[model samples]
Target: MTMVSNEYGKIITIEQAVEMIDDGCSLMVGGFGGIGSPPSLLQAIIDKGVQQITLICNDTAFPHIGVGPLVAQGRIKKAVVSHIGSNPIAGQLLHEGKMEVEFSPQGILIERIRAGGAGLGGILVDIGVGHEWLAKGKPTVDIDGNRYLLERPLTADISLVYAKKADPFGNLIYDKSARNTNPLVAMAGRITIAEVEEIVPLGELDPEEIVTPGIFVTYIVQSNGVDWKWIWE
Candidate 1:
């Protein structure tokens, strides 16, 4: 088991955060592309040689960014995400039958994760009903004379998230557009590790400004402060 402190949201090194995970673990990673990815923690996983992971994220990101490196490094065996257009490596693996990829609608994907955190059985939606390819073998629910697909909740052994700032207690505030899917990702993991640019004192974060509550976070790692220039810029 990983170390747990009563001190509440203790800040640890990326190496220590890596110790909490093992090979073949299920992970939910928070990011749209690589914008809000946890670089230090992701690097730690690469360094530790963890492999055969099942990843849940919005996308695989570009080949050089975010969890894309993990894919490039062959650490992921299966990925549940919206698309792999950004990462040619992921697409290569998918087509080669080297990786198992599950495609889910973006809205349904996040909602399923949120449902997992909320302890729900699953959710019902009609996004893929008519498309037999999308519907596949999933069970259908008829509610109020309408049919919908039963989307199962997705929970993970651990979740990795990036935040702009965090209090010692683990309350987080993301930077601008980097906030995507992080709050939901923070909630869906059995244990969540946050990598943040700054870790302030416990009271530094205002309650109203806090996006993800400390209760959802198990550990925190300060960011490496490397500037990630946006491709658009």
Candidate 2:
């Protein structure tokens, strides 16, 4: 389907955005730790009380921040992520066998998202080949007499992304450091829902700055403050 620019950019509250996601969905959340998190949206989702989510992200943050509330509420069933060191709740859940965790290297995670966005089956990376994780009994296959590990595609039913600015065309631009995982996550979903701090007219955004194109985006919502646990604030 072709994504067209709308004259009137539909602006909805954070509550409206969270209601669109249902239970038992594969969700790709854009952020690293708590940096690029869509806090208000996360809170709304926690309020909605949806369960059995398969969350895909770079890292899982702490109990009170980022995806923490969902984990604290026992909403997430599984998570495929790169890092989990910061979130002790996640660790406790993993130990208790309450939540399933699939760990991936950071680079491979990005490649998996890219593959999904491009409609590819999977990605083959040497990073996992002969690694302790794979050697310890994970599946491996030989391709053309070369041993390679398969990193499955990370397609999501819904993608929750935070951006600095979004044009009515659905094109997105994210600020520095905040852009982590956002662009890739946006493409890897069937329905890409973006939360932007600012919404601008179509063509207002520079072509060079457009990280996510309009075709991949399905919805746009405006957001207020982000949720970050400071070590700073």
TM-score leader:
1
Worst 10 residues of 1 by lDDT: 1-10
Tens-place lDDT per residue, model 2, 1-233, is 33435565545667777877889988899988877877777878888888999999888787778787787777889999987888888988889999999888899888999999999988877676766855454457788988877777889999888899998878899999999989999999988888888888777899998988988888888787763446567
62 Cα displacement, candidate 1 (Å): 0.3
Write down the RMSD of all candidates, one decimal each. 3.7, 3.9
Best by lDDT: 1
Task: Provide the global lDDT of candidate 1 against the true structure.
Answer: 0.90
* Candidate 2 clash figure, as a count: 0
Q: Clash pairs of candidate 1?
A: none
Model 1 off-target regions past 4 Å?
Answer: 1-6, 230-233
